[model samples]
Target chain A: MRIELALFASLEPYLPEGESASGRRTRMIDLPGGITVGEVVARLGLPDQPRVCFIDGRGVREDAVLTDGVRLAIFPPVAGG
Target chain B: MGSLLRVDMACLTVKKEPVPAGWAKYAGRALTDAIIFAEVPPKADPLGPANKLVLAPGLFGGTPAPNGGRLSIGAKSPLTGGIKESNVGGQFAHSAAKAGLAAIIIEGRPADPKALYALDIDAQGNGMLNRVDDLAGLGNYETAEKLHAMKGDDKLVTVTNGPAGEMLMKAAGIAVSDPHGYPNRFAGRGGLGAVMGSKGLKAITIPLGIESLPHADKEAFTAAVRKFANALKEHPVSGQGLPTYGTNVLANIINEAGGYPTRNFSEGRFEGVEKISGETMREITLERGGNVKHGCHTGCVIQCSRYYVHPDGSYWTKGSEYESVWALGADCGIDDMDGIAELDRKCGDLGLDTIEMGNVIAVYMESGKAEFGDVQGALAALEECAKGTETGRILGDGAEATGMAFGVERIPVVKHQAMPAYDPRPIQGIGVTYATSTQGADHTAGYSITANVLGVGGTVDPLKPLGQAELSKNLQIATAMLDSFGLCIFVAFPVLDIPAAFEAIYEMATAHTGDPWDADALMKLGRETIAFERLFNESAGFTAADDRLPAWMLTEKLPPHNSVFTVTDAELDSVHDFVAETAAEMGISKP
Candidate 1:
């Protein structure tokens, strides 16, 4: 299945050089069907915890499964007022 | 505990009083709120003789507690016309604490309308009032430079204002010196600096070479401080991400979440986000030989602050926080980091709230004074504010006055104060806070960005209304307690995720006071502080109708999400209800 992977802030280096054609800091990747967010982060060499994932801009559990064309975004914890 | 110093500007007298037995347990906002409630009249003009400005060091202030040097400034706001409290990071509060003063309360306007006095506290804590005529109308940067050279002591920390305050503009903010002697740390909301000016005050300087902050249980406090510091280092957000990128790291994430509040809140996202992003800012700072991991105050291990440098490697400004980036960059449609840095510097040096200044500039743009993204035009307008022209005076007060003066409709503000970085339409939790906060549309009052975007405290859908009121209420309660310890709120990132981190904070506070405390007790304390503020606002003529977002935000749909502030008015009214109810549930009565 084809999915869009978005890496933000400190996680950006994991993405390939330059932004993809989506006009954002995202890249398209291929993953197996029913891939959990945990497995996806692991495949991307990310920690299992302390990272938040959003599917289609909605925060989701790490165990949530991905479907085709799912936009998955991962970000390290960040804060400011 | 130390004595409270009351500086009477009317008669130019200073009196020292013991920390009242009833007020001994309270410090920071707790003590400030109690004093404001007891002394200030609800209907007093915020800039008149009846109002007072109270500065307090938190519970662990003057101690070796990490991030324990913050100071709280409280008064009736000239902008909001209600109770206001703004906190800032600097070396001032910790040194003030070491000087054996728990609080400094400024009251009454002097008979000499042109009188400008400087209050100096020497190393031995001797207080004196002097006439510093040269500092009467200088900007904060030049004033700090002159005062530092005048004092010729590395240990002195100063808090002063620019000509904006000298002119009594409502947008004026008090500037506090960082370690580098730059007056960049600001208690920059609610027009508190104007209050200082109205009192005929110029500056306050405290020498900070004290060997150690007296601690009740030095051994136990040291252990608890060590544990809290270790917990901060162990956390990913506070330790790793913030130290590297500073606060602008949220640029991309907030933009991605479709809640960045671009172009005067007319749009939810900006196309030029990358140009002003934290990643880009970090890259530029390092390439220019700048320090990215600097703390605003000493003993700040989180170090989510930075010193932005010019191309030739000279310091430009200290803060490029997410709000400043969003406010000056996308809010005005300008994307250049260098220009934003310069504008940020001008705002800091002139003692203006960058958020309010940005809002005023954006409103000016919307009025067709200048095209969006016109960097030169924005700079020209800033020059006017610095000059204190007739138009500049209107702009200096904030967006409400600017809109009124310029005949612009669709202005975005709550309680006469400009909204911060996030658009309320998409981020409804913060909308609740912006509407009901005692300080008026302040993000720090209840930073729902933690749950809304960063996923720190708890996950909440930014576009939805469900779970928003509760999220804001809990964070508001927790934040009040944190602010009292003179601790930076950045610690909340770790405390949200790690139970041990929260426990460490509780232990440290309890050890300092030598009193028992738990999560419930902490919440109760925070609730009481907020309750007093609410009571003051209520008596000052605020009603549920005043707790509302701008009318346009309810009707105008933000882009991408096509969302409005769907949080019910009833919900916005209930945002602070948890305080009283929780107090009753815990069988505690707030006087």
Candidate 2:
């Protein structure tokens, strides 16, 4: 399945070499037909720290299963008003 | 010794007194709280002649501490009728410290209501209180520019109020000059500006030059400062996240958590989140040829401030931060960035609290005074405040009054002060702080989010009601200590996780002040600061009943998160017990 993953702020430093810049990265990976959102974070080598992940615009838990051709956004340490 | 400058408005007298012994133990908010407790009588009206306004710089303000130029302004709030401490960042603290002044106390209102006075302190430590007529009715921006022109250099630091303050509006705030002569930074909250206005004072200006004070161990201080700065550079939030995105970064996160208050606390999410989030702001600024990250004062490493520009690269606004964005954008149901920018500009010009002003307008909208998503109507409301019109009078009365006027029951406030952007139903820990803090509903009173997130062993999940009261108690005490040091709360992000970094800074303070102390001693001082404020509030007729969230929070359930503020009254009462136990652990008795 193919999907796009984007990182922001300090999380950009943890991205793979070719995908470390300021845009989205397209990657293809083999899955067991269906995989949970937790598996996607682990597969991308993202931090294991608890954080909110967004699929398109809605919040989804790490255990929620993902589908092909979805856009994922990963964030680190929430901060706001 | 750092001296106190006292200005008596009625007599036009100025006195400088040496700093009292043991005051060095507490700085910033702690010091201001102590002073307010010692001098002002509780029964006195906040707008009456007996009330006093106290301003104190943080402990590390003059030094090269990262994000350390925070100033605390304490007074009896005209709006809340409780003890209040409002903190802001500006050049005033650095200048005041350079001039060897510990705090500025203004007391005794002028007998004449029409006369306006300006207080100026020169390099020789001598102060001049003059009656300046040209400053009357001038907005903050124009007042600052005229004062700068009158002083004829960048040597003077001016703090002024707009028509909102001059008109004695309950939501008024004092504006301080930014580095670029823009009156952007503000001591905003609790209607302290109205207190100043009631005194018949227009502004306070300090003219300072480069001067160094004596240090106990310069080498040790330098070494500890360098180590602390290095530690900050290593942390993600302090090192990069804050510098890159400022506090606006939380818009998306809060929206995702379903905790972002939208449209008068009706929902927890806003559909136009993308336009107001930090990422979008950075992108928009870049496209508009503006600087995304800028520092507030000298020696600040975490430059979370920014200069927002328009499409033509014109100066649209300065320091368009997170609270202002949420208050003026999401809460008011206005999604246009240009409209938000214009509102920010108007708030700056009028010397008003953006949070209170925005919330007041939303109340007006709810009452059918204006329609939802009416950006032009919002602008017109701000214009009324600038011109001091009849509608402006209603708008300047703050959230509680506006809510009362409109008969809106969903008003989000605690202690008569408007709550900040964070809705407490989902994040219950902050709700605890808002309820218990002496400064009324303030988010920065104790920002326990970091400690809670790091799972610092005893902390509870924000989503759960269990142990949140105790957690908030600890955070409030710790934050009081940080505020006393005059250190920026942002330093706590790193200092909490790595205690050694803060220890080094504490050692430096002890070495400089020649006071025998450790971390435990600092915590004791924080407790004392809180006790003093509590005492003041108690004397001012505030019982435990006054320390609570608005009724709507308990009865209403915020959507998406589907969480109601489940912390009961008994749990809230236990918070005071937790504070008392902490004091006992430190071998201190209750005040």
For every candidate in turn, the CA RMSD to the true structure comes to: 2.2, 3.7
Q: Give interface RMSD, per candidate.
A: 1.5, 4.3
DockQ of all candidates, in order? 0.62, 0.31
Q: What lDDT tens digits, residue by residue, belong to model 2 across residues B285-345?
A: 8888988777776677878888889889888888478888888999988878878988988
Q: Model 1, A1-81: lDDT tens per residue? A: 988888887787788554374646789888899899998888888755588788876678889999999788888877666
Per lDDT, the best of the predicted structures is 1
| Model 1 / residue B308 / CA error / Å | 0.5
TM-score computed on alpha carbons, candidate 2: 0.92
After superposition, candidate 1 runs with Cα above 4 Å error: A1-3, A17-19, A22-24, A30-36, A63-70, B578-591
Per-residue lDDT of B205 in model 1 = 91
Q: What is the TM-score of chain B in candidate 2?
A: 0.96
Candidate 2: residue pairs that collide? A79-B250, B58-B486, B59-B485, B59-B486
Highest-scoring model, DockQ:
1
